[model samples]
Target: MADDETRVDAAEEKPAAPSDSDLFRQSEIAADYVEGLLDILDYDGDIDELVSAGRPVVEVVGGRLQALVGQRGATLEALQELTRLAVFRQTGTPSRLLLDVGGYRANRRKELAAVAKNAVEKVKEHGEAVRLEPMSAFERKCVHDVVNAISGVESESEGVEPSRRIVVRPAD
Candidate 1:
């Protein structure tokens, strides 16, 4: 009887799955944190939060959000890290939240995809390796994805940060 009771107690102690409420709470907390940041910088932007692509995504859209995005999206990446840290502080769990400003990430992603495809074609046509200009980690990821999707070419990142480029070679 004690063994059976122990099994029943263990089942009762199992935690429930995280519901949509849990996800939305994360977004709300993130929005508040970002709002404070904008306030401190005297920046103006509209914050929109929602579940996108199965993850929490927040976008700051406005003219003044440019500084937040920074050159080559460096500031934007930093802001993303700070936001994740804020979320972690509140929830005690790391977040995979995506933050976009002034539609920069969306536009950049499109451009990166094009660059990757072009490199892919070059590798296929010439049967030689193609080296692309250095790109950020996000950009490298986009290129890696495109190359992975293509059949004849493989891509890898070489070099160091701020100069890390993608090398595309024909798959052996």
Candidate 2:
């Protein structure tokens, strides 16, 4: 019909959202960047790139790659940001890319989950707020997700970066 044709024509004038293939391209760029870094560092690792959780993820698995993780994943986090920048430079889009080396993130998530559970327990038992030590944004997010799932308890992030912490308290 004429009306339908008109609508289609008007819609075509507006830019569309990024498609799945565009997102996949971001991962490809990030993977290439990471591979170059690995070559420069003379590190041996297997890289797998994919899109997950609506973001690009680059996973590196190998032995003796603990140095890539740094102390408490600091180096890994920095690497992720750098990869994201590489993606952005090519795509002109900011990315929420995730980079994991040697199962570090998986291990850290399990450990942080335990810490969150402990905080939930303390809040429930004492009916008082329990404050956790300062953590990176990723760590705080993991803790928040765990605590938010439990009933009668809640968690909030306070303070600024490098000093920010989570506080678990009884729900109202």
Candidate 3:
């Protein structure tokens, strides 16, 4: 009986991980808040929330949401932080949140990945460093991951925020 209890305990001891529904709930709450804000501002944008890359992401699409995104997405970044703060206040847990406006983030990430791939090919061909255009931290991270996956090459970021650029070079 003791051995049986031990087996049961071990079986129940799976690694702790949040469920997808829990993550989706966070996105839903964020979307509701964002929708209310849009309504208050008399903005016309469709809000969508979903789980992407294991994190909650909210996307607002419409001409009016452009202001929420701001110049170079500065306003969008600020709004994301504020949304995370609101979520944390309610759930008492910090969130790895992602917010996209007008599909900018999704489109930008795709473009950055392509740029990174091109730089990787250039570095492999010429054995010289390839400097990419300035990108946000999230964009840099995506590039870094893509570059890191390839052998004989590496990527690193230089300069400061809003001006930070990624450089891909040979592994050696």
Candidate 4:
């Protein structure tokens, strides 16, 4: 009986998953932060925030917003971190906030997916490992997902941030 009571207590203590409303709130906070940033930079853009894939995403669409994306998306990554900090300050919780400018990430995802598939094909044909160019965490994750879905090939990241890359090879 004591064990059963303890088990019940543990089950009751488990935290509930965040509701969609909570996710939307986080997105709203992040959007506000991004909007302020765009205003400060004197960049004109339309900002939209919403919850997707269980996380908050803020997208900025405008002509000539490439400056915000920076080279290799470095600036965009930094902005995402800053936006998440803003959300954390408001909600007292760390946020997985995705910030994009001028549809860069959407286009990049499609490109990376193609790159990953090509790498997979190469590994399958050559029976050897193939190293890909350095990519952002999000980019690497896209490749990882694509490679993971395929059989007889595996992908892993090798290096530190800003230089980290994915290596795809035979599963064995």
- For candidate 1, the per-residue lDDT at 123 reads 89
Q: Per-residue lDDT of 1-172 in model 3, one digit per residue for the tens? A: 9999999999989655557887898898889888888888899998889998789888899885678878877888888888888778777778888999998788878887898899999999999999998887878988998999999999899999879999999998
Q: Could you tell me how far off, in angstroms, the CA of residue 87 lies in candidate 3 after the best superposition? A: 0.8
In lDDT terms, how accurate is model 4?
0.92
- What is the C-alpha lDDT profile of model 2 across 1-172, one tens digit per residue? 9999999999889666567687788888988999999999999999998888777788999888988899989999899888898999998888878888999988999999999999999888999999999998889999999999999999899999889999999999
lDDT of 2: 0.90
Error of 3 at 151 (Å): 2.9
Q: Each model's TM-score?
A: 0.82, 0.88, 0.80, 0.89
Choose the strongest candidate by TM-score.
Answer: 4
Best by lDDT: 4
Ranked by lDDT, the better of candidates 2 and 3 is: 2
Give lDDT tens digits, candidate 4, residues 38-109: 889898999898999988889999998998999989899989998999999999988888888999999999
Question: Residue 73's C-alpha lDDT in candidate 4?
Answer: 91
TM-score, cand. 1 vs. native = 0.82
**lDDT at residue 6 of model 3 (Cα atoms):** 98
- TM-score order, best first, reads 4, 2, 1, 3
Candidate 3 residue pairs that clash: none
Off by over 4 Å in 4: 1-15
Residue pairs in collision within model 2? none
lDDT of 1 by residue, 1-172 (tens): 9999999999989575445666667777888999999999899999998877556778889886788888999999998889989988999877778888999999999999999999998888899999999888878988899899999889899999979999999998
